[model samples]
Target chain A: MLSLFATDFIENSLMKFIQTSGLMAIFSEGGYKYVIMICISLLLLYLAIKHKFEPLLLLPIAFGMLLTNLPGANMFHAELFAGGHVHWDIFVGKAGLIDYLYLGVKLGIYPCLIFVGVGAMTDFGPLIANPKSFLLGAAAQLGIFLTFIGAIALGFTPAEAASIGIIGGADGPTSIFLTSKLAPDLLGPIAIAAYSYMALVPVIQPPIMRALTTKKERMIKMSQLRQVSKTEKIIFPLVITIIISLLLPDAAPLIGCLMLGNLMKECGVVDRLSKTVQNELMNIVVIFLGISVGATATAASFLNPRTLGILALGIIAFGCGTAGGVLLAKFMNLFLKDGKKINPLIGSAGVSAVPMAARVSQTVGQKDNPSNFLLMHAMGPNVAGVVGSAVAAGILLCMLG
Target chain B: MTLFVIDYPLPWSNILLIALFGIAIVFVVLVVLVYIMRLFGYVFTRKHKVTNTKAPLAISEEEVVAIVTALRLYNSALHDKESDMLTINRITRMYSPWNSKIHGLTQMPEHHNK
Candidate 1:
C-alpha cells in the first residue's frame, strides 16, 4: 500500500511537469510558426550585431521578438490590446512585463518623447539658412501619399494602408507614432520596415538618385548658405509650433515636443534639460519603445503575406520619395539662374534620414566632381524633411484616424 | 478624432483624392513656412543694414591706422632690450644633515664570518 501511494505521487508530478513545459507547447498545434518567428528574430539579431544595422534599436527589438514568441513564457499578451482598444479592466491582472511597457507605444507617448530627443540633438540652422529646402522636404512626402494608394490597391484597409505608407517617411519615431495610432496591429512590421529601410538608406537611395539626375545636374555646386542669427533661431521654434498647431491640430503633440526640445537647446539657458533629453531620456525611451513594438510581432501577425506586402510597398515608398525630391529640384532649376541652380542630387536628401541621406548626396556628388561639397547644402533639405514628414503624419492622422 | 467617416477599402476615386489633398496640404504648409522665414530674413537683414548705415564712423581709416601704429610703437618701447644670449649658472649649497646623500641612503650591514 505504501509503495503504491509513492508511485502514484511520482507519476502525477512527472505528468504535471511535462504538461507545463514550453517545449511541450512548441510541439503542440500550429507550433512551427513560432519557430519561424524565432528564426526571423535571430536573423535580425545577427544583422544587428554583425553588420551594425541600426543596432541601438534593432538589438532590443530582436530580443523582444525572441521573448514574446517563446511558447508559454507569457511575456506579452496580444488579447489585452485586441481590436485596437486597450481592455483597461483586465489589464492589471492579465498583463505581462512587455504589455505594461507597451502602454508607452499604445498611448502614443514614446514616439513623441523620442522626438523631443531628436529635436534637442538637431541643428535647425541648416533648414533656416535655406528656407527653400522646405520645398524639397515637402516633395519627399510624395512617397507617403503615393504608398498609401499602393497599399490600398493591394487590398489593405485605409487604416492599415496609412500605417504601412508611413514607412516611406524614413523617420522611425513618426512612423511609430502614426502606426500606433492608426493600425496598432501592424506596428511591428511597419517599424521593422521603417528602421530597416533607414539603415539601408545609403544602399537604396543611390541607385534611384543616379537614375533620376544627369551628370551635369549632379555636378552642380550650390552656393554657401547664409549665416543664421541667434535671434532668428530662438524665434523659429515658437513660430513653427504656433503655426503648425493651428494648421494641423493632430500634429501638435509631435511638432510641439520637437520644437520644445529645439527651443531648450537653442535658448542657451537649459543646457541641462537639453542634454538630458538628448541622451538619458532618449536611451530609456528607445529601449521601451523598441521592445514593445517588437513584442507586437507575434507569429500570427508577422508570418503572413501582409508582412511581405509591407516590405515591398516600403521600398516603393522610399524610391518615390527620393525621386520626388530629385525631380522637383530639377524642375526648380528651370527658374533658378546659373549661380543659384539647385543640385538635384541634394534633393534626394530630403527624405529625412538625417545626416545619412545628406552624406549620400555629398558622396555621389563628390564621385562626379571631386571638388564639390554638398553635405551642408544637402542638410537644408534633410532637416526640412523632418518637419515635412511630421506634417504629413498629421494629415494622415486627421484623414484616417 | 477622424474628420471623415469612410468605409474600409475606400473607393479608387476617394483614395486618389485623399492622396492629392494630403500632398497639397504638406506643400502648402511648407510653402507658407518658407515665405514666413523669408520675411523674417528680410526684416532682420534690413535691420542689420540700417544699424550699420546709421552708426557714424568714430574715426577716419587713416587716423585709425595712425593711432594703431602709435600704440604698437609705444608698446614696443615699454619692453627692455634683452641680451641675445642664453647661459647656464651653477650654484653651490651649504651641506646640512637633511641634504647629505650619505645620511639619506640606507647602508647594508656586513656580517663577519664565524
Candidate 2:
C-alpha cells in the first residue's frame, strides 16, 4: 500500500510539469518566424506611439498583431480564416473573439458604418458651393484604373488587381471594402499599404504637388465660395443618394449610410444622434476594424513576395493619383476665365484622405503665399473625392463582384 | 477561380474596356450631379432673393411694433446685469510652438519656467 501511494504521487507531479511547460513548448514549435513577426508588430507599435503616424488605428492594430502572435495565445488563426472564409466550428471555441469581430469586416459592415460616422462629421458646404470640384475628384481616380492595368501587368487576377488598384484612392475604408469583397487573401497587405500611405500623405503629396505645378499655379488665389443655404444643405444628401443609388446600386450601402448620416446632421432635429454617430459609433467601429485587420497579418501570410509587391505598387498608386488630380486641375485652368482659375495645389486633396490631405494643400499653398487660405477650397475636392471613390468602388463591385 | 487569373495571358481588350467604362461612368455621374447642384443653387437662390425683396413690403407697421415690444419684454426678463451686455473681446494671435499641441503632449516651456 505504501509503494502504490508513492507511485500515485509521482504520476501527479509529472502531469503538472507537462501542463505548466506547454507554453514554453510553443516557442520551440513556432520557430524563428514568430520572432520576426513579433518584431514587426513591435515596429508598428513604435511607429504609432513615437512618430504619431495614424496613432488612432495603428496603435490598436499593432497591439492586436502582438497579442495574436504570442505563442499559445490562440487569439486568432489566420490560416483557418483565409479567402474571406470563416469556419464557425473553430470560431465557436475559446479563441474566437477576433474571428467574430472580423466577421464585421468580412461582410463589409464595419467600413459602411465608418462611412456613416465620416459623413456625419463632414461638412458638405464647400463642395456644394463649388460643384466643379467634383471633376477634380473624379480625375483623382485615374490612379485607381491605371493601377488596375499595372496590377494586371504584374499578373494579379482581375479581382485581385481591382483590390490592389483601389489603394490608390487613399481611402482606407473604401480600400478595405473593395479588398474584402474581391480579394480577401490580400486584405492584410492592402490594408497596411493603404493606411501607411495615408499617414504619409504630407510626405508623399508635397513633392508631387510641387513637381507638377509651378509656383505661380500654387499661389493662384480664387474668389470666395458662394454661401450655401440650409435648404440646399438638406437637399444635397437626398439628391446624391437617389442619383448615385439609381446609377450604381452596388454603392447603395456605403453611399446610403453616408447620406443618412448627413441627413441626420443637416435635418437640424437629430443633432444628438449625429453627434453620437460621429464620436462614439465611429470610435467603436474603428477599434474592431483596426484590430481584426491587424490580426489577419500572421507571420506565414504577411512575410511574402506579394506583400512586397503591394507595398511598392501602393506608393506608385498614390503618386499617380496625386499627379492625375494636379494635371486635371492644370487642364481645367487652361479653359477657365481668369477670376475662376484654381490653385493646382488644391487638386492633390482630391485623394480623399480628408482633413489631412486638405491640410497638406493649405500648408503647401501657404508656403508659396502666406495670405492664401486654401483650407475651404481644398475641402471641396476632399469631400468630392470621397464620393468619387465610392462611385469607383461601386463600378468595381458591379463589374467584378 | 476568376477567368482573369494571374497566369492567364493579358486580356488587353477586357482591361481597356474596364478602364474606359469605369472612368466614363464616374465622369458622367459626377457631371450630372454638377448640373443638378447648379439647378438647385439657381432655383433656391432665386426664391430667396424674391422673398427678401417682397418681405419688407409684406410686414405692416403694427407687426414691426409688436416685434420690437416682444423683444424688449424678453430682454427685460433676462438677469439684470446680463441685459444689454454685449462684450466684444479681441483675440490676440500668438505664434508659439506650444500652440501647435494637437495631441496635448509637451506643455508650453513658459509653464515650466513659471
lDDT of 1 by residue, B61-86 (tens): 78878999999999988978899999
TM-score of each: 0.91, 0.85
Evaluate model 1 with DockQ and give the value: 0.33
Q: Give the RMSD in angstroms, all C-alphas superposed, for model 1.
A: 7.1
**Which pairs of residues have clashing backbones in candidate 2?**
none
**Highest DockQ scorer:** 1
Worst 10 residues of 2 chain A by lDDT: A18-27
- lDDT score, candidate 2, position B47: 91
Error of 1 at A289 (Å): 0.6
Identify the leading candidate in terms of TM-score: 1
Tens-place lDDT digits, model 2, residues A1-401: 99999999999998887655535645576557777778988998899899998888888788777777776677777756665676666666645578778889888999999999999988999999999889888888888999888888778888888898899889999999999899988887888889889999999999999999999999999889989999899999999999999999998988898988999899999999999999999999999999998887877778877788788888888998899889999999999999899999988999999989999999999999999999999999899999999999999999988
List the DockQ of the predictions in order: 0.33, 0.29
Candidate 2: lDDT of A56? Answer: 89
If you assessed candidate 2 against the hidden native complex, which CAPRI class would it receive?
A: acceptable
lDDT of 2 at A363: 100
Error of 1 at A368 (Å): 0.8
- The alpha-carbon deviation from the true structure for residue A386 of candidate 2, after best TM-score superposition, in angstroms, is 0.8
